[model samples]
Target: MTQPLQIGLVVFPEMTQLDATGPLQVFAGIPFFAPDPGAEVHLLWKDLEPVSTDAIMTITPTKTFAQSPPLDVICVPGGPGVDALLGDSEVIDFVRSQGSGARWVTSVCTGALVLGAAGLLDGYRAATHWAAMGMLDAFGAVPTDERVVIDGNRVTGGGVTAGVDFALTLVAELVDRATAEAIQLRIEYNPAPPFAAGSPATAPAEVVEDYRERTAAYQARRIAAVARAAAARPTP
Candidate 1:
């Protein structure tokens, strides 16, 4: 029997649950991928304690960073915790270390910030929450506005809802297009947003401006976090 693909998902305090759970649900829904009919998905956190999201959702992590199994893929999901994670040496080290062993490294939403902070996004094409894209260039990454962007071994998705598309894309890349299509069909992955405000170009000018204004503080915090992380790194 083929060994199940072991996926490690890193969860942090204040993370957006959908960013992690969306991809997780997609992968876990694939029954034929493993001998036991269930693929292995491990939620790794700094602590094994329950992690809460900004939305007040919480989940228990399966493993701590030190105890995580070897991973075929490492997925980092983003939320307010990304500000904290960007400056966390232990978390960044864990990401950098495990990412080297994994066949693929991916992020959803501002989780790409963590990858950027780890220096993994350097010279790579990446996407993130539109509010956070400007900072990717600070880490030497080329920012794209697409919902999903793949560059070599790195895959990134834009914003919260993009996780599903990112995971489906990854499914096609790792297994086969047939498998991905089957899963998409099973999940009824077709999307039709009720409103056109999903993208900056489609949103009213005032709404787009308001979003940028509201996120200004968070962006400032992220910038400081990234600068601190970059400065603290020992000369390679």
Candidate 2:
């Protein structure tokens, strides 16, 4: 607990914007939490350059791996770019180093795979995007499918949208229930979607099938990347 909680959210090409931004918004607003009234957010990348995301927007890194200060929380977001990240020693090493000292190690969506690749998820029960649930085992993680999953100091959000929930949960843990509720209410973090197509269990079967088909090639590549990363992971 300090005046400014240092939080770093990883950035890379083709990452799901919401995966990082959802948590970023929550962390950025942490000053509103009276109990712990300050939080410094850092967008981390290999360099201080603009990184494109799947949402078509771009995020410029506020800190590079070499320049990043010790973080209280380290979060890696997931997307198509995670495939390359899975095998990226630099990114993996950065995550591993941060996670080793951070109070919280987290991810949303396929970013869990990157954490897994970094040898951080072994024996941990973590959550990720539904499509990547089974991939956790490659990193010795017990696959979970909940909106948010917390195992010790490790916290993971299911998919992109789950990042907000994940961060609020962290707020509650780091600050208090009152601060978290106040922030939630101030942000009007109410969930009332028009359709129930969020999850495969409720989504139209045809829609699920279509999506699976559409992303088959991409998923295959991600799976292969996970395998390679797992193989390269140093045994503990």
Best by lDDT: 2
Query: For model 1, what is the alpha-carbon lDDT of residue 43?
Result: 98
lDDT of 1: 0.87
Which 10 successive residues of model 2 have the least lDDT summed? 28-37
Model 2 score (lDDT):
0.91
Task: Write model 2 residue lDDT over 172-208, tens digit each, in one string.
Answer: 8877888788888888999999999999999999999
Model 1 clashing residue pairs (backbone): none
Per residue, candidate 1 scores C-alpha lDDT tens digits across 1-236 of 66778888999899999999889878976666433424688999988899989887798999999898888899999999898897788999999888878899999999998887787888899999988888787778899999999999999999999999999999888777777788888889889889999988899999999988998887788888878866654433
TM-score of 2: 0.97
Clashes (backbone N, CA, C under 3 Å), per candidate, total 0, 0
TM-scores, each model vs. reference = 0.94, 0.97
Residue 129 accuracy (lDDT) in model 2 = 96
Clashes of 2: 0
Name model 2 segments beyond 4 Å from true. 35-37
